[model samples]
Target: MNEILDEMNGHEFKFIYKTELFNEILAMIEKKKISMENAILLLKCIGYYATLKGIWVSDFERSLLKERFEKMIKNEVKKKEKMNENLLIDL
Candidate 1:
């Protein structure tokens, strides 16, 4: 997963990681292993790894990336909420 992430460019990397993390959370949900709230919170932290790349990204860029990551996370959470609502209705 890290290799795949490394191969992606900056903009692409954020989207890809958000997708992969969302999928992981969905799997955990399917397995009845995690609460929806926790899964969503974990998704929000997926971009912390970017901090470790201090040498690669400038402070300004990192801040911008963090904002973008937050927006991506918010969007993912909204998607999950809608899906959960549908699932509940189906049940």
Candidate 2:
């Protein structure tokens, strides 16, 4: 059916796939093999590319994603700061 074909070719699929890739990147960051900043940068870049390619993410959804990524990066920075402080204390 034409409707089914249209649905399959829609932006929803692209958004879902992007979200999954973002989650995978987060997992890699959690495992300490990559930095949170790096992950966020990659996500943003990819999102921008997708936008240019006609993906339709609303401003609200983009804001939410940005907020979550910023929070995660802040947490990582705080963690590293605490670690350095503890190292100083130990020294």
Candidate 3:
């Protein structure tokens, strides 16, 4: 749990692609209006599905990922608030 939180605190998302599927994923993210972290998590899950054949992602992994994603968003929000406060004070 701590490890997950740590990773989320400094997570960077990137993917390589050149297909309609990539555009579809972007469309869904935009439609949902989700955070970048959520979009990256979803993309990771999608990649797992596309690459892995018979192997399956366990329910445990899914649950853990969801929890971590939420934590990441919360942390980001807090950071943004702090930055906004500093900006307001400067202005």
Q: What is the lDDT, from 0 to 100, of the residue 86 in candidate 2?
A: 34
Model 2 residue 60 distance off true place after TM-score fit, in angstroms: 12
Which residue runs of candidate 3 sit more than 4 Å off their true CA positions? 1-18, 27-32, 54-91
Estimated TM-score for each candidate: 0.32, 0.45, 0.29
Model 2, residue pairs in steric clash: none
Ranking by TM-score: 2, 1, 3
**Candidate 1 local lDDT, 9-55, one digit each (tens):** 66664545554455555667668899656654554344444544432
The best candidate by lDDT is 2
What lDDT score belongs to each candidate, Candidate 1 first?
A: 0.50, 0.54, 0.45
Judge candidate 2 at residue 16 and give its lDDT.
52
Model 3: lDDT of residue 91: 19
What ranking of all candidate models by lDDT puts the best one first? 2, 1, 3
Q: Candidate 2's C-alpha lDDT?
A: 0.54
Q: RMSD to the native, candidate 1?
A: 11.6
Off by over 4 Å in 2: 1-18, 57-91
Q: Please, what are the lDDT tens digits per residue for candidate 3 over residues 1-91?
A: 3343234321121122334444555566557767545667655664454344333323323343445445655665688845544322321
lDDT, candidate 3, equals 0.45
